[model samples]
Target: MNGPRERGRPGGADAADRALDDAVALANGPATARPGSRQPSTDPLVVALGHEPAGAGPAQARTRARQRPDAVAWPEARRLARRVGRRLDPRALPLGEDLLGMALARSLTALTDLPSFDSSAMDGWAVAGSGPWRLKGQVLAGQQRSADALLGGHAVRIATGAVLPPGTTAVLRSEHGSTQLRTDGEWLHVLASHSAPRAGQEIRRKGQECRGGEELLPAGAVVTPAVLGLAAAAGYDELTVTMRPRVEILVLGDELLDQGPPRAGRVRDALGPMLPSWLRGLGAEVTSVRRLVDDAGTLHAAVAASTADLVVTTGGTASGPVDHVHPVLAQLGATLLVDGVAVRPGHPMLLAQLPAGGLLAGLPGNPLAAVSGVLTLVDPVLRTLAGRPAPAPYAAPLTANVPGHPVDTRLVPVVFDDESAARPLHFTGPAMLRGLAAADGMAVIPPGGARAGQETAVLDTGALAPAWGSGA
Candidate 1:
């Protein structure tokens, strides 16, 4: 009763007729169906030719791909981000007291030699002769007295850091000399046990630590509290350092609440409150944070108008109905330097070069995924822009086995236990932040995972102050 099947048609005339009717109905349906319904076609050829299944379209396919991203390897994503960051020009900032965490743009040179003048190293008597000596006036620190030459049997009481008078010989420490009243004013008698003083004992000579114009710190040195002290001691009133990379954060989502608890499908904006401080820790100066609704035009305008060196967009990176990042980037002629990263919890993340000479980092909606994007892309970009050297790769043995993705790298939060091994923490799902909050660092697990006792690279999270010289 049924006619022969047409080419590309699996069933007979009845099935073919039904398929054609279904295709026609789909062509006439809404351009974008409900969230749960099949997505519409993004490919014009598929719609024009009407060859796809009744409900399946290019848009649907794209959306599915986004849900499970076709990503590049994690290392490649980091390289791309670093390359883009290195292209940015380094800006010089005045080295003020607030320069902590900034990288030195150039080598810091000493303006004056340390211990610019010969000074006493302890509270002592500057003696010219070896035996009993006549006492002269005292020399206190900062007193600009004349450099009177001392006679063969003369001595002057000098305090630590006091400039040594001309023609002074060995110094007699206070405990090593006895003072007595004699006919010729007061006299200082060196005790027999301490009579012999080394030629330069108790004296700090000029330029002992560093000479004038010597390099105190090299370029790319991170300014720390001790660096500030050293700069001051080296007679430097200001420093020339690389400026922190300026960043703008665009928090996107219609279902995000600015404050209060999550209710009725709306969750509090976690990234908004957390990103600013985190970016600062990464050497970025966050300029502003704007919460945006899911509007393509608005996002486009925001991206085009941003003047910051980098713009970080949170959420809407996928190809879902509410996801508008890709289309906007396409319209603006931006280059997708990193389409996606082969890393768990943040596989949908992307990095793009905005047409306006700025870079854009797209973070996924999930809390943990956003953190992953920060470590994988934002950290490297900001570090490079700040003129900081790439952190040396270091690894720690794993105390327990960590599950890994078949093709992607896994960044699992871990705590260092008593055995000095990184122990993986649980509750590290893409949407959760509990594990990250309790973790010290993230263990980078390679493909196929690692067994217990395997050495894995640990990414510092700025969670705790690093041990002295351990570099985290």
Candidate 2:
């Protein structure tokens, strides 16, 4: 039935190619559809999985990272993002309450005005433009309004935050005034500044800095002290925010020990001491952390009963003989979201979704890889759990040549200029942790690579800078 002998090599049949195409076409249809089964709707999911197709298999992630315009490429990044979107939730709180308790656990809404009204900004005399007045009375903050009338041609001694009486348009500091007894029994003399005060001077007007209900902070903002104060000034008692994910850590490897004399070949666990502080900066509340030896059964039992919202396991994710994580995860039916990222020193890092509505990330045993995983994978997930937005990367001109493979997104440590402009410092491999500790932030070398003079985007460490002296 061959139409004609094809002029090609003996094994040149395109059967594999044809079969692949057919399989791809059928992948959009249900496997057990009957001959008379009706086609599903053209919507992506409907057409891809067919009508009534086995519970739509946990929302398919948009993992075509290569198609994205950005240079950094990590398959796990997108999958983790979608999983975070599905798992975390954000809510709002009232104005006036301090952002503590659960409120501190969530990202705050925007801020409003500080004073929220026109109030005196200093301890002074509130006077009208037509001075040469008599002493009317004195007013301090928190004093209730009384029948004391501040007449025209009179001045009132005012304390900070006091509401100005009608017709008073300016405030002259207390040092500028002279009060004296008048000859009349019922009068006291007041000499206001000879230069009549200007109207609206030293007054904080309502909505001057921020109006009522104006966003004092964008959504997904980390509630810092400044942000906290701003929110309070807006008259908010409480604010709705996204809840942070509860995390549990398990540091595995028989070569690790804690607080004991180091055995000949073993060492003290670095993760046990370092991970908690690192996790907090990502806004995650670590519920628990345990150390377990590399045993599949033991790890499985521990993970099965763990109730945390997320679990991070360190070491033992590779294919080495002692690597129990991969096998145990497989046995537990964990969905492999990311088996291995191409980034150096972090090649063994794994991101998987636990069957029980949470995520599991595995970091390599090396100190550098372990830290890299935190910055690249763990940081994003923790931010998601905290309901914070993915911060935009900071762009900077590369000061020198940064080397790396064309496919991997390299994380290089860097510092910033006084004006917050990022500048790369040293290049450290994934196995090198010294440079990372010295640098203030990490810059990403996007896939397709970069030259010494090209501009690059750096991720800044969100550390609070020291308060500088104003006079300096």
Candidate 3:
């Protein structure tokens, strides 16, 4: 939830801003509700210092109402975030230990011809003509090329990957050719019924796989482990790759505790410990995670000082006494892009551009709501910046009917079963995390909801990627 509007805000809190917020809040429901509760038709609450009266858990989020005519539709919100990233500049880095999962900035052209030399593709004998052939010296991989050249009908013992001797026309695989020590010399002969070695058989011709300077992979390809191997095999000691988008996390809320159990009047800070790892999986270099109390000036300083490509913040999206996020944005003359999304529990989430540099993702304070924001907004943008391609969208039938949000789309945690159907889990309220912890994915239930056996879109979180870093 958000804190109160700070004093002397930009053009001063005129009647127009208040009227606009009220209309948008009324149109969307209350600016907020209890995190996990269903949307309620109610009037906006009078908040102070960014908090609601005594017992009402902080009002959900500030309604941006007409700021966007209405909150953006769920899918559109994602696309908007992606567009923001595409507009930003992409960084490039030389191949190194940190290149894993980064995207290719340019096509990976071969530094040298693949195979670079005519070489044996299998353990065989390099021969100039059909058998029976005279056999001479042996050739093994990694040895410098022998000065001797094979003559017509002459064969030499060779190993897989060995450079083919000059004048050799074809290779006879060891299994297909038999060698015998005759009275005068060694000779190799093909199998009794087997055919003769065809020209270029069992040989890897120079530049056959690719010519020097030929493109191996196009731009925007992710750098996977196999890609690294391929790059090394192609005689490349260096590669140009897309740099991971740098991100900084700003965790706001004075009532949140980072350690131990939630002490008197304080809940544990959940997002602070989770988002960094999650962001990395979605392709981001989380530069820092800073926890700040509900102070407008402090929040302003942090966001303004940040040099990262993205600045993700928790809470202060709603108009609560301490909800300072929006006010701070206005103070800095930032452009609000996706002011709010029409997703349950995360309707207050926002995306904006900083005046100086960087962008900010304002995630709702609720645990699960914040996660929804991360999925619907953060992932697409970060992946765009890092050059990671979006996963193919797929759907599965649901096991039950999920309640709808009238005008908003819903993302419910679900577990996929052998039937390839999604079993929607309970406890998936905007504020709840129990169902999500055990879920395979979040099912995107369209507005008006989906009935049992209906195919619903499933979102991938890319959680399978390794969470890497030095120990915290």
Per-model tally of clashing residue pairs: 0, 19, 22
| Residue 338 lDDT (model 3) | 90
Kindly list the per-residue Cα lDDT of model 2 for residues 64-118, writing each as its tens digit: 2343333223434533543453435655655432333222334333355555556
After superposing candidate 2, which stretches have Cα over 4 Å from the reference?
1-72, 75-79, 82-117, 146-149, 184-194, 259-263, 417-427, 447-449, 461-472
Model 1 TM-score? 0.78
Leading candidate by TM-score: 1
Per-model C-alpha lDDT, please? 0.74, 0.59, 0.74
- Please provide the root mean square deviation of candidate 3 (C-alpha atoms, Å): 13.1
Misplaced by over 4 Å in model 1 are 1-69, 87-95, 128-134, 150-153, 167-178, 189-197, 463-472
Q: Model 1, 54: alpha-carbon shift in Å?
A: 49
lDDT of 1 by residue, 1-472 (tens): 1111122322342343233223222222222234554434533213323333223334533443455466766755776687686634545555465787777888988898898988888897987866588999888899976657888889899998899888787788999989999786999987878646767778888899889989988787778778889988887778877777889999999999987899999999999988888887777778999999999999999999999989999999998999999999999999999988878889999999887788999999899999999988888788677776554333456788777765566889988876557889999999999999988777777655677876555677643432111111
Please report how far candidate 3 places residue 189 from its true position, in Å: 5.3
